[model samples]
Target: MSAVGPLDAALTVPAPAVVEPGAYARLRELVAGGGAVALTGAGMSTASGIPDYRGPDGTRRVQPMQHGEFVGSAAARQRYWARAYVGWTRFASARPNPAHRAVADLERLGLVRHVITQNVDGLHQQAGSHRVLELHGTLDRVVCLDCGEVTTRDQVQEWLADANPGFLVAVDATSPVRPDGDVALPEAQVQAFRPPLCLVCGRDRLKPDVVFFGGSVDKGVVERAYTFVEQARVLLVLGSSLQVMSGYRFVRRAAREGIPVAVVTRGGTRGDAETTVGVDALVGDVLPALVADLRG
Candidate 1:
C-alpha cells in the first residue's frame, strides 16, 4: 500500500480477462475436499471501501513501494508517512464487506482451514476469520526496526497529528485514498512535512508493520504458510492476480504436487495454467451466494 511515484508504464497496465461463467460450482467442488486453505489478495478488500492496486480487470492502478526506498531514502520515508498520516482515517474507517464475512462464515462451517492473505488491511480478522496468516504485516500496527518495539498504528498517527497539524486537510483535499492505507500527495507537501520516528527509542526508523514490495516476507512466516499448504487437501485462491511470485510460488508448488487448486478472480491470473478450476466473477457476488448456499 506504499508507493512513492508514478510506476513505469509497464507496471500500470492490467490483465483482467474474464474466464467462463461457472465459478460457483467449480469453487464448491474445490472446497469439497473439506480442508481448503484460502489464499487472498488485495481484490478481496475492494468492496470494503478500499481501492485495490489492480482493478477487477487486473490492471495496476498504483505502483507499490519498494522496501529499499522506504528503509534507505529519507525523503521517500517522509513522503510515505505524510500520505499515510492523511489516509489513516480513511483506512481505519473501512469495515468488513460481505466478501470478508462470507470467508469467515465458511470457517465457521468447517469448510476452510486457514486464510493466507496478501493484503495488510487486517479486514479478514475484522470480519471474524480466525487462524489467519497475514503474508504481509498489517497497517493497524507499527514496528520499530531498531529496537523491535511494537505499537498500534493509531498511536503513531496521533503523534503525527500533533507534529503536523493541518497536514491532512492540506494534502487530503486533493488526494484520493489509495490501496494499502496510502494516499497520493504532492512532493512539495511531502518535503514540507516531517515524518514520525520511533517514540520509544526517540531516534530510529519506524515503518508500518507491512512487508513492502521487493522485501522478503519473514522466513518463519513463509515456513508456516508452507506447512498449512502441506496439510491442506486443496488450495482455494481468491481475488489475487498472482502477479507477485511470493503468493504465486505456492500455487506453482501445489500444482506440481497435483493438489487440487481452484481460483476465483475477476481477471487473468499468472497461475491460471496451474489452476484446476478458474472462476471469473466478482468475489463479493460469488462468495456471499456460496456462503448462503452452504448455510442452507
Candidate 2:
C-alpha cells in the first residue's frame, strides 16, 4: 500500500489518485468471491459537521468530563453538564451526510456484511445500515454508573436544561456554536453553571455511553467485531487515522489473518504500512463513486 499524504505532489500534482470508475466493481468482485466488512472512523461524519478529534492538526480536545473526575467531585459534574447543555443541540440536530448514505447503499446491495465504527455518532444507523457494531458506544445515549439505567441522551439534555435554566438561557442567547457538544464557554460562566443529577437516583453523576481515552470497551464487543473479521474476506477502513488502538487493532488483525485491507482517509494512518490498499481521498467523494461502480 502507498504511504502517500493527501497533498503529496506525486499523487496530487497531475491528477488525484482516485479509484477508477470500476472501484466498486472491484469491491463487488472481491465480495461475491468471499466475505466483506467495513471499519469506519470520525472522517465519515466530518461532512455532517463533527470535527475529527485527532487529525493532522494534532490538537487534543479535552473531553467534557472524565469518569474519575465526575464520580469523585460535585463541582466536576456541574461543569460537565454546563458544557453538555450547550452542546447537545448541535449533536442531536446533525444530519447524516452523503458518505453515510453510500455505506447504507453498499449494505443494501449485500456487499457489506457488518460495519464496525469508532465514531460515537449514530449516523450509520440513521442512514439505514442495520448490522452495525459500535466499538465506541453511542453519544445519543446515557448510562447511569451507579444504577445502570440507560436513557436517551436527548432526555438527559432536557433534564440538564431544566436543572440549569440560567446556563441554557445563556447558551441560547449566544451564537449557538457547538463542537461535538463541547462548546467554548468562558471559564467563569462554566464554573458558575451546575450539572444535573441522575433523574432516577437523584445523584449529581451520570456519564455518556461512550468510551473515554483511558476507558476499556467490553471484551464482548471486541470479540463480536473479530467474529465479523474472521468471517470476512476483506476489511475496508474509512475516514480514520487509526491513531487509537481501538480502530488500529482491526487493521493489524486483518493483515495477520491474510485479509486484504483497503483504507480511505484524508491523512496518514498509523497502519498505512500494513494496509493492502490505501486511497487518500475524501470519504464523501470516494464512497459514492465506489458504491456506484459496485452497482454498475
Candidate 3:
C-alpha cells in the first residue's frame, strides 16, 4: 500500500508557482526513458465537464460533504441523495477527455506503468486504463451502512428514478455540479426529498462507497499504491493541486527514492519542492501534445 499511510489530516500548502509550458517536452523525454506511475487528481477531469474541488489559488470554494455528517444524520443523507440524484445525469454523461485517453495511450506505448487517481469519477477506466487504483473510492458503487452489501450506483439510480419520477426535472439541471456528483440545492428542498434506503435490511442507510473528507482510505488500496510506487521508475502527477497529502506523500516517497517526479497541473502543489520538472498547462492539451511529440 501507499508509504503515505492512510490519510490522517489535511495539509497547509502554499500557493504553487505557475511556470510557462517550457517543460512538457522534457517530461515526455523522462517518461520515454522509463515508465512512470501517475497520481492524478480532480483537475484531470475538468475537461470532461467535471468541476474541480478547488480553484487555481488552491482554496476550496465550497465545503464537501463530510463522512460523519453523512453517517450520523438522516437530513444529511437526504440532502446528499437529492443532490446526487440530480447531478448523476451530468456525472454519468461525462466522457473521458483527451488527458485520460493520452494516459491510456502512454501506457500502451510503454511510458506509463500504472494510474492512481484521487478522483472518484471513472474517467481513467473509461479511457481503457487497465492498471488503475482509485485512491478514493468511486461513485459507481454504494454500500449498505449495516450489512456492507455493495451495490452498483446505476442500479440505485434506476431505483431512484422509479421512486422520484419528475423530481429531476423539477430541479434545475444546470445548477453547479460538484466534483462528486453533488449539486447545490436549497436546504428545504433537500430535506423534503425522499431518498432510497437499503433493500437488504429495509431500514438501514446506503452511502456511496467513497472516502469522504473526514474518512480514511482503505489500507489495502494504499498498500497496492505503495507497490506501484516501488516498481515505478518515475512518478507523474497530473491535474491535482496536492492540497491533501495522500497523493503528495507518494511524490515525497519518489523523491526519497531519488526517482524523478514530473508534474503537469494548473495550480500550486504541495509536492512542488520535490518536483523535477513541472508544466503549468492544461493537462488535456499537454498530454495529447506529449503523445504526438512521442510519435515523432
Candidate 4:
C-alpha cells in the first residue's frame, strides 16, 4: 500500500514532535517485553462511513436531539424511530475497515492484550477482536425500558414496522433526512410512527442499548476496562478525540500510572499532553504502517 500523509501535519509537526519513526519499534519492544492495551474511539470506524459524532460534518450535519427529548416526549421518540428506521440499514450495514482489522491482527500477534472502545457500533467485534470492552453500549441491540429484556435491533425494527404500517410511508414521502430524524414531515406525520414494545414483557417501550451523551456507562463495564489497563505495560489510543470522560478516563488512569501512551488519530485530542507519543494521522493509513514497522 502507498504511504498516506499526516492527517494534520500542520498542527502535528511542532507539538510533542511527530510520533517518532521509532515509536512503533519502541511499542514492539514493550509488547515483546510484556502485555499492551488498546483504547479506541469513533475515529477507528470513520473510514467505514460511520461519521464521528462531533466531526465538522458529522451527525450534526443536520440538527441534533438532546437526551431529554428522547426520553421525555412521546413525539420525540416517534420521530427518532422514524428516522432510525430509514437509516438503521445504513448504520447496521457498515463494515469494519482496515484500522479495525489491524487492531484484531495486533491482538492475534500478541501485541494487543485488550481493547477498550467508546464506539457503540460494535465494529471491533465485527473486525474479529475477541477481548473487547465497550465503554458505551452497542446499537445492534435494544433493551427494554421496563423489563430489562434485550433484543436484536432487527427484531425491534420489524416490530416497529408492524406497529406502524404506512407510517414509514408518510415519513418517506415528506420527512427530510436529518441526523436527529426526519424533520420535514409535519410533526403529526412524524409522530404517527410508534416504536414497538419489548417483546418479552409486552411493554411498548424499548431503547437502543447505548449510552447517550448525558447517560453514564455501566460501572461494571468501566471497572473491567480499568482492570485491562492495570495489567498492561503500555496503552495505545486510536481514532479518538477523548472528548468524553467515558473514553478519556482510561487515558488519565494510564497517565497517572506512568504507563507509556501512544496515540494515533486525526485532528486534536484532549490527551495529547498526556501521551508519550502522538501520531496525528488517519488510523486506516497509519495503523498498518506502524504495525509493519513493529514487525520489522
Alpha-carbon TM-score of each model against the true structure: 0.90, 0.85, 0.91, 0.82
lDDT per residue (tens digit) for residues 1-296 in model 2 = 11111321221112224644334334434543435799999889888987777655334554434557766877766666676678777777788898999888878877788999998888999999999999989888888888888888888877766766766666544544343456677778888776666778976667888886667888999999988987788898988888889889988899999998887787678988888767777899777765665444
lDDT of 3 by residue, 182-288 (tens): 89988877866789878888754899989988898889999999889878888999999889878888888889988899998986688889999988877886777
Q: Which ten residues in a row have the lowest lDDT in candidate 4?
A: 8-17
Specify the highest-TM-score model's number. 3
lDDT for model 4, please: 0.73
In candidate 1, stretches whose alpha carbon ends up further than 4 angstroms from where it belongs are 1-23
What is the Cα-based lDDT of residue 87 in candidate 2?
75
Candidate 3 runs further than 4 Å off:
1-22
Which sections of candidate 4 miss by over 4 Å? 1-34, 56-65, 166-189
**Candidate 2 residue pairs in clash (backbone atoms < 3 Å):** 35-233, 78-195
Whichever of 2 and 3 has more lDDT, that candidate is: 3
Q: Given candidate 1, what's the lDDT at residue 45?
A: 87
Cand. 2 TM to true fold? 0.85
User: Could you tell me which 10 consecutive residues in candidate 2 have the lowest summed lDDT?
Assistant: 1-10
Q: Residue 8 error for model 2, in Å?
A: 30
Estimate, for each residue in 1-296, the C-alpha lDDT of model 4 and write its tens digit.
12222232222222223455555444444544437799998789878877666662222343455667777776666677767776676677789999999898788777788999888788899999999988878877888778899989888888878887876555554333342222345566666666677668986667788777677789999999998987788899988888778888989999999898888787778887898877666788777655554444
